[model samples]
Target: MAIIYPLQPRLSSTSTKIVIGLIWALAFSLAFPQCYYSVTQHYPPRTICMVNWPDDYGGKHHLTYQIAMIVLIYLLPLLVMLITYSLIGQTLWGSEIPGEASDHYQNQIQAKRKVVKMMIVVVMTFALCWLPYHIYFILGSFNKEIYMQTYIQQVYLAIFWLAMSSTMYNPIIYCCLNQRFRSGFRHAFSWFPFIKVSEEDKMELQHTQTFRMTRSYRTENTKSTVVRHNSTQHDDHTTVKLMKS
Candidate 1:
């Protein structure tokens, strides 16, 4: 969206980049397993309480790791995204740019709304997909009995796939809702065997390109006009001085 839409926030500011880097580092550091002591050499039993521990460990560190993973990976990121998107949404819809017409402004607002809506959908999908996976860990961390149940392994497999499936949906979302991505997808598809790019696809890609070019020209033209007007006034003043002399 940032590539196609000029108005989209790119977060190119140095401070913002630094903050993002810090956040990513923190999340990554927190996600690493700190309780390697609790990890079994083999997988945990599907239906037994007969696990041998090297020491008289109470698995408190394991619970802490599980809680950290849930907070850092899922909850923390989700909260941050929600807040960021909310600010973006307010900026898009609340503020109006000068010289934009009512209809054009409305269209811009609608476009931003779509972008925000897409972000929200992505976040929600992630939450839903990963919910079961995290819930399993949370349950196991708090209740050893549930962790030792016969059906626990099967449940883990199910939630694991559910979480894994979220990664697959992002491309579909982009192709379906984003015009630039759709055009790019079509262009790429044209290279495949027995596939040809349609004229409409070509036109859509060209149209977006042309629109950007036109905007650049308009901005440059406005600056040129101001300079020309100042030059014209100076020329007139010189002519008057020559006539008076």
Candidate 2:
């Protein structure tokens, strides 16, 4: 959605939602077999030093499938995210809002830049976390001797956990990088005995709300001014026609 923001859309919201759902469903479906095998068959037995199950799970054909799944799930998404963010960064830096309120325009652009930065961090984190884990599997699948040593097995365990831990880091990143999330976290945890919402945070939240209200008021005022100008023109035209008649 950020990719096409502030522009007229060629597709409806329902179509966009359906397209997103279908893409995610397909990606997950492609990924289900590896998860199913790990859960139902085995959990990285020391014998195989990987998540192979049923004794023939890592057969030549299955290796091919796993390779494809890696491409679809990990690599492809990273590539697309990088491209999308590059475009967004360019657009944010290149475009300017048309108004006399240059300060407000710059503030809006800065806010968007912050959002893009957060998203880039997220995308890079995902790729960094999974790349090593997937490499371990790819090596194990093709070169059976790669997993023989105890040290290598330990390394594999570390990489596997690193990938699993990726899901745990995003909220922390958002909390640290995004003010809205910080304010939200404080509010959500305000009831806790140890958590304190600081005075600065309260002031920041109030300032944000005020800014939004001001923008809304300006928009409404502009619309009303246009309407009044049109009405005045119509009344003048009617008077002129009455005098001529």
lDDT of each: 0.75, 0.80
RMSD of 1: 7.0
lDDT of 1: 0.75
Model 1 C-alpha lDDT per residue in residues 108-184, reported as the tens digit of each score: 66766776677778888888999998888778766778856898778878999999898788878877777667777
What lDDT score is found at residue 43 in candidate 2?
44
- Report backbone clashes per prediction: 0, 0
Total clashes in model 1, counting residue pairs 3 or more apart in sequence or in different chains? 0
- Put down candidate 2 lDDT per residue, 1-245, tens digits, no spaces: 53456323457899999999999999788867777766433446533323455656457756777689788878888899898878887786677778877886777778778878888899889999999988887777778788777698689789989999987899998998888789878978999999999887897788889978996687678779999999999999999999999
Q: Candidate 1, residue 28: CA error in Å?
A: 5.6
Error of 2 at 113 (Å): 4.4
**Regions more than 4 Å wrong, model 1:** 1-28, 38-57, 94-111, 212-245
Cα lDDT for residue 51, model 1?
34
